[model samples]
Target: MLEEVKNYKLKHKNLKLIPITTKNYWEIGWLELKKEQEEFVGDNFKSMAYAYATVMEGKYAKAFGIYDGDESIGFLLIGHNSYSFEGCPKTLMHSYDLWRIMIDKDYQNIGYGKDAVKLAIDYILTFPDGEEDIITTSYVEGNECAKHIYESFGFKPNGDNYEDEITLVLKVK
Candidate 1:
């Protein structure tokens, strides 16, 4: 899986999902969404904390900074077999979840979000943590931008909800 992701990085050149690290944590921490957009995606810091908690519980979770070359433009977090998480819907127990994603306000609507989605799908396809038959994600009810992006990649809502957010899934196997 690592090899596949490496090959993908070489081909893409500009856009990549670099895992969070001690050296680059500060830069990623400063990445932010627009004020109104925060309501939909929540805050990156909170997402990171959740990822950390998920991992500490002996499950799979990974967080990355979405970068274009050397610039940090967004954040992404993914988890596998995460249905055991306290609030997760039982329907997603066996899936890989694109748990969270956010592009900085400065980088929105200029294809960065679209490219990041592609990079994320490529990464998930590698099955970095473990194998899963499908990938899942969700967006808040009114977040049309997220709805369009996920749907563009063939993610269909599966008639499930986690709080106010609607669940969408893409079958990969």
Candidate 2:
């Protein structure tokens, strides 16, 4: 799966990483996160709720939608966060958090989620050096599937947890 994802990102003419904008925000926000997947996602949010909260409240947040041809399959958000947990540190102000990641139920098991994760990490690596090189995210306990996918791409546990989820970090090198 890792090799498949890496290769897909290289020759990805069909997959696209599109910025979530005002006009098309509803498209991804409205996509289903499915009830079974909700336990892993740590919330009942329908992607758009995260979008609205990020847009209207958390000024530091940014959202994106994943597209395969014309179909929106996944949604994710990234932003600076210092208050999402209790032991949050000052260095995190220079860091970014992947606040949410989800693929539509119908889109599961087809590698869309893997491609989306690659896209997000690639996007994070685009910044100039000395400008925050860490990206963090979490998955609720019992979501070993998520942990495996993330770990496949070099994300490691940084000994942190948010609520019931285990925190993981990827350092862009």
Find the candidate with the highest TM-score and give its number.
Answer: 1
Alpha carbon lDDT of residue 28, candidate 2? 75
Backbone clashes in model 1:
0
**Which of the numbered candidates is closest to the native, going by highest lDDT?**
1
Superposed model 1: Cα runs more than 4 Å off: 1-13, 85-87
RMSD of each: 4.1, 3.8
Global Cα lDDT for candidate 2: 0.69
TM-score of each: 0.89, 0.79
Question: What is the Å distance of residue 103 in model 1 from its true position?
Answer: 0.4
Rate residue 116 of model 1 by lDDT.
81
Model 2 lDDT tens row, 38-105: 76763324455655675576346667787888888878876765344456644355677777788888
Kindly list the per-residue Cα lDDT of model 1 for residues 1-173, writing each as its tens digit: 23322333333369888998877777887888888887898677787888888889898889999988898999998888866757878657888888889999998988887678778888888898888888889999999999998887788899878889999988887
> Which regions in candidate 2 have their CA more than 4 angstroms from the true location?
1-12, 42-59, 81-92, 128-130
Which 10-residue span in candidate 1 carries the lowest summed lDDT? 1-10
Candidate 1: clashing pairs of residues: none
